[model samples]
Target: MEAKKVALVMVDISGYTHFIRAQKVSAIHAEEIVFELLEAVIDRAEYPLTLNKLEGDAVFLYAEIGDNNLARVTRDVAKQVQGFFEAFYDRARTLTEERAECGCDACSRVHDLRLKVLLHSGEAVFRQIRQFEELAGEDVIAIHRLLKNDIPAREYILMTDAFHNLAGNLAGMAYTPSQQTYPDLGTLQIHVFQPSN
Candidate 1:
């Protein structure tokens, strides 16, 4: 492994903390549901994605050595990520509708369920070290910046240009625009979160 060819993932569920603070059951329910959905995707996919852990209503993940490269765009990675978000988002939408029908007091306040997915290509792997994951470089930093400073307020599946560049010749991907400006951080693009119909 010259450099760990991985897709650094940082996905978050909106209103996670607020739900946790207001109701334990809702928070727990939210976590379980989200985790289950994520876990299923990771499990079913043949790509190199893994479940790092479930933190609050957020799931930290990473996809390892798939079709990511710097030749063209992340045709494979983008499609997989977009598909995952759409699937989960669709399910999340169903969950929201169900809550209204169930009239569950705890879940009533959850007006929306959205995810922010950040995928980065970098060098390093964290495998049962019981120690830590090394991400001390520009690649990791750029990803953080994309998620924190670049992505829109309410968007889903925003990927770094680094990932897209690796798509190689594959085409047909619709991503949103990035609000933050980071010209030095390679090609940064944000897919304006849309659930697949």
Candidate 2:
């Protein structure tokens, strides 16, 4: 089987569990907020980047490198990332105002949620099982391992060096070099880009 290069993106909600537990929010209300936020992110995704699946408080997206130029792909991914955050913050504000008088725990704390993204570009083996398309390879494992990083910021985009090398310098963005050791994946260098609101 021929291996193909693909970009992997994961948009995850931080403070989800802590918010629920600390606020003592109901499961139903928590689920509603999470679902709504995840849906907003999904709605912002553009072509070439397909939604792989929804993983709890995160959305997994993947796009085949194909013949598209790196500049075009980078711009597209950056746009999608920007769009998701814009929609996410907008929705949070709207929910906050709508529930200002409700006094419900979930409604009162919806704005506490934060968004972060993990990006990596590498080779993968694609397999189609029933209705789902899955990407499998060491790269896939590496991207997931990035989620367990010790970044100080709550909201930031962390990209693997491989991705940064291809995406180049994103406009209006500054990246800080960082590294973390994963028990299984060893030590990997990463770049963190924190977008200003």
Stretches off by above 4 angstroms in model 2 are 23-25
Clash count for candidate 2 is 0
Q: Write the per-residue lDDT of candidate 1 for residues 1-197, one digit (tens) a residue.
A: 13556666766666556555666656666555556556644654445456665555555666666443433223555566656666665666666777666554445654455556666676554444455554445666676676556343565566555564564322344556454467676555543444433
Error of 1 at 161 (Å): 2.3
Model 2 per-residue lDDT tens digits across residues 1-197: 45788888999999988877866646677778888888888888888789988888989898778656765675578667867888888878877887688667887889889999888888888888888778889998898888888898999988888888877656787889989899888888888988877
Error of 2 at 73 (Å): 1.5
Model 1 Cα displacement at 183 (Å)? 14
**Pairs that collide, model 2:** none
Total clashing pairs for each candidate: 12, 0
lDDT of all predictions: 0.56, 0.83
Residue 38 deviation, candidate 1, in Å? 3.7
Choose the strongest candidate by TM-score: 2
Candidate 2, overall lDDT? 0.83
